[model samples]
Target: MVNNRSLVIIALLAVLAWLASTSLYVVNETQRAIKLRFGEVVETDIAPGLHAKWPLINTVHTFDARVQTLENGQSRFLTAGRNALIVDSFLKWRVVDPNRFYQATRGSTDRAEALISPRVEQSLRNAFGSRDVNTIISEDRDDMLADSMASLDTAMRDEIGVEILDIRLKRVELPEQVTQAVYQRMSTERHAEARQYRAQGQEQSERIRAHADRQREIALANARKEADRLRGEGDGEAANIYANAYKQEPEFARFYRSMQAYRKSFEGNNDILVIGPKSDFFRYLEHPAGGASK
Candidate 1:
């Protein structure tokens, strides 16, 4: 009788422990929980805490409520010019309505992402639809995506219960053929510009050099003319001096001229003169007087 009473008390305590274990649950600070009654959502978003539920009648589904990132790589879209672009981008989002999120994705993160990715891609496509590669590269990309971003955020909030906090573009690229063509065109344009610059430089340099050469020629001619004038004036003054000396003393002038001639005639030892003894050239040698020895 004592052993039966002890066994009954132990069994009752064990059942109570099992019930408590099943009925009580905990939700972390970074998580959100949903209470479902027989797989039908009864309580929407249960805040983070220890919560109680009817054992075996209600269950809890918890999800990470923190912000999440969806990496979108290599999504192809068309431009206004009908050219193709490969876009690499990412999205920042979080679940705002856990009930709707659970309903739409059935608590599957993968399913939520699959639904969100196509919409993001479509919004990006809409933004890119009016722009070509040239316009995209050369213009403000923010203006292009502003309307689409807002619209996508609204749509994601409504449909997937996810809030789009941000969208970012990592890279936008063209096909190999298009890239090569663009490079070739740019090279040709650069070459043409360089040729034009060189041509202008050469023309200006030639003009400057020609102007310098002309100025040099003018300066040399002026110098030569001045030199000639000065030389002619010197010779004329010397002739006038000689005339004045001769007018002052005719006999002295003749004697001085005769001496100068004799000095030059015997200036070099190798000099020789052969003349008649009675030549008028020897009149000075024959006599010292101006009239010679008669």
Candidate 2:
């Protein structure tokens, strides 16, 4: 009977040891815990190590409070200008207010993700709806994201009570239909620009040709006028020289004119002349002894 009593005591000590070991749990440097008694949360501990609770009456729930990175899948959304774009995004988040997170999501990280994802999508849609396609795709995209992050911060804080470390866009793309349409429009615009440039060049060429033609016409007209003026001046000068010579000495002028005519008429190797002695052609050679003055 004493041996049976000793065995019962040893079994009780063993049970007690097991209970004590299960009741107390040590949290790691990166972990946090919450205590629950009969489906009610009794306490939450953030600092690591050596925590105590009632044996078999209390339960401990541990959570990873470290920062986590989540990469979102690509999604299609419309810009404010009604242009469609494919956007890929990512976020960094942590479990802030683990108590609220546990109550809201029931201590499941997947549940927390399910709750956060829709809000992120909603925020993305709202931000995307407030900007044009050019702004979203261009260098100004950083500014657009900045604005979106601010908006996300406000929304997440007010609604989820969770701190979003950062939200970033990985890529933005045009849908196939939108891409084809944009390419066609760009091609048409380039063709129009080329047409405009060709038209301008043609106009400039025509203007240069017209200007050259006008200059040529002006030069030809001036040359003709100068030629006619010089011809008239030359004729007038010749007529004046003749008149002056005749006025100076009438007889000498007649003799000189006859000599010039003879020179021109007799210049060729072959020549003929016919004249009477009594004619004026031989008057200068007549002597007074051979003919009477009367």
Best by TM-score: 1
Global lDDT of each candidate: 0.88, 0.78
Give the TM-score of each candidate. Answer: 0.79, 0.62
Global Cα lDDT for candidate 1 = 0.88
In candidate 2, stretches whose alpha carbon ends up further than 4 angstroms from where it belongs are: 1-13, 154-161, 194-294
lDDT by residue (tens digit), candidate 1, 109-146? 88989998898898999878888778888877677777
lDDT of 2 by residue, 1-294 (tens): 999999999999999899879877888888767888987888865568888888878888888888877777898889899888899998887776667766777778787777778777877888898888777666565566676677766666555445688878888889977798889999999999999999999999999999999999999999999999998999999989999989998767766776677678679887877776576554444642223222
lDDT of 2: 0.78
Clashing pairs in 2: none
Model 1 spans with C-alpha error above 4 angstroms: 1-10, 225-294
Please report the TM-score between candidate 2 and the true structure.
0.62
Give model 1's TM-score versus the native structure.
0.79
